[model samples]
Target: MNASDRTPADLLRSALAADPARPLVTFYDDATGERVELSVATFANWVAKTANLLQGDLAAAPGDRLALLLPAHWQSAVWLLAASSVGVTVEVGGDPADADLVVSGPDTLEAARACSGERVALALRPLGGRFPQPPAGFADYAVEVPGQGDRFAPYAPVDPDAPALAVGGLELTGVQLVGRARADAAELGLAPGSRLLSGRAYDSWDGLSAGLFAPLVAGGSVVLCRNLGELSQEGLDKRVESERVTNTAV
Candidate 1:
């Protein structure tokens, strides 16, 4: 298929086949002094496992809306791709009450409990650890995802024209999402193999585009930083130098 006809999942698959050993995402939590890097193969493995969990265990379907109540962490990125792989619509920071499934971070547990659908809670801890115990009304993602198959196949083929993402009162189909991401990557001067360091939060289009989708569309990699306020100008510069960052979106 041509690039314009490809979905985000297709982009990921291409990246996996083209350069499995290259870093696709490098995440940093400045507040907690944590850093994690995932190669294309590693990230795709996580996506596969999570996709299996969503499709098999959670019974997710193409039109189902998955409320993603998480921040700009690497795991959140994984969930985005997993939902795309199964043609499940991702509602970032959306109201859980209307969702078919809810995936929440530690801080949003109370709000997520209001959703009646299946719930998954993420610790967002270092190494993507599980909660010490399962939350009252939710399954622990880290625990369940590990037992899932390392490879995933959707029950049915994903439609590129299907609604895929909803954020900031805007929704886009899978094809539209990929098209916009490709344009944004070009506008931002992201070439293949570029390393982008981004400190934008994922709640808005600019952040999501810069920190995740653009890099994926451009065949580049992202160094997504959370709690960026904790970094001084010097520290930030040092990170850019150390990480070989070719672009910055702060």
Candidate 2:
């Protein structure tokens, strides 16, 4: 099979084997004013745990919709990894109404459900939001959710053309998104161990699949910016000059 034919599981298995401990994903945490680095192995484990929780605990059915309204933190990465672990397709958006389950920040929960999540709860929130500045009523995900499952179960490989994510009527399925990611990685020359300076937003058109998932599933490091303004002309120049970022799909 061609690179485009590689499944998310295929890509993930490769990344974990190559350098599971290597910094695969980074997030700028607004609450702590710091960068949170998640190693691929640990992230993979979390993904497994999350997939199990969603499947066994939450009783999430295959092909059922999940909404991730998580803050732009490391947990957002967890949601992505977990969703991929299961064959469950996720509909990440500001709206929870479109989703059967919703995971969001303490403050964002109400809006998350109103938009698409059915009966919003705290299970889908980031761990950081719990401690110092927990949103009013929500409990810590660890505290509220209590247990985290061990491993992810096997599911049939999703159809390439099955609808994976949607915006209005526009939809991209698992196989379709992975195909595009591989194409982006190749067309952009994303090599293993390459660092990407991404100034885009996950909610934006390009950032979601291309800036983030494409490089990641391709085995590249992504330096995410919480704000585009932070990647100022000077900052961009410095990152490119100093970090030697091979590509900027932002």
Q: Tell me the whole-model lDDT of each prediction, alpha carbons only.
A: 0.93, 0.62
List model 2 lDDT by residue over 187-207, tens digit each.
Answer: 777878887767666664366
lDDT of 1 by residue, 114-225 (tens): 7899999999999989888788889999999999999999999999999999999989998899888988898889999999999999998788889999999888999999
Off by over 4 Å in 2: 1-6, 29-32, 115-140, 144-146, 155-161, 167-169, 231-244
Q: Give the range of the ten consecutive residues with the poorest summed lDDT in model 1.
A: 1-10
- What C-alpha lDDT does candidate 2 achieve relative to the native structure? 0.62
TM-score computed on alpha carbons, candidate 1: 0.98
Q: Which stretches of model 1 miss by more than 4 angstroms?
A: 1-5
TM-score of 2: 0.79
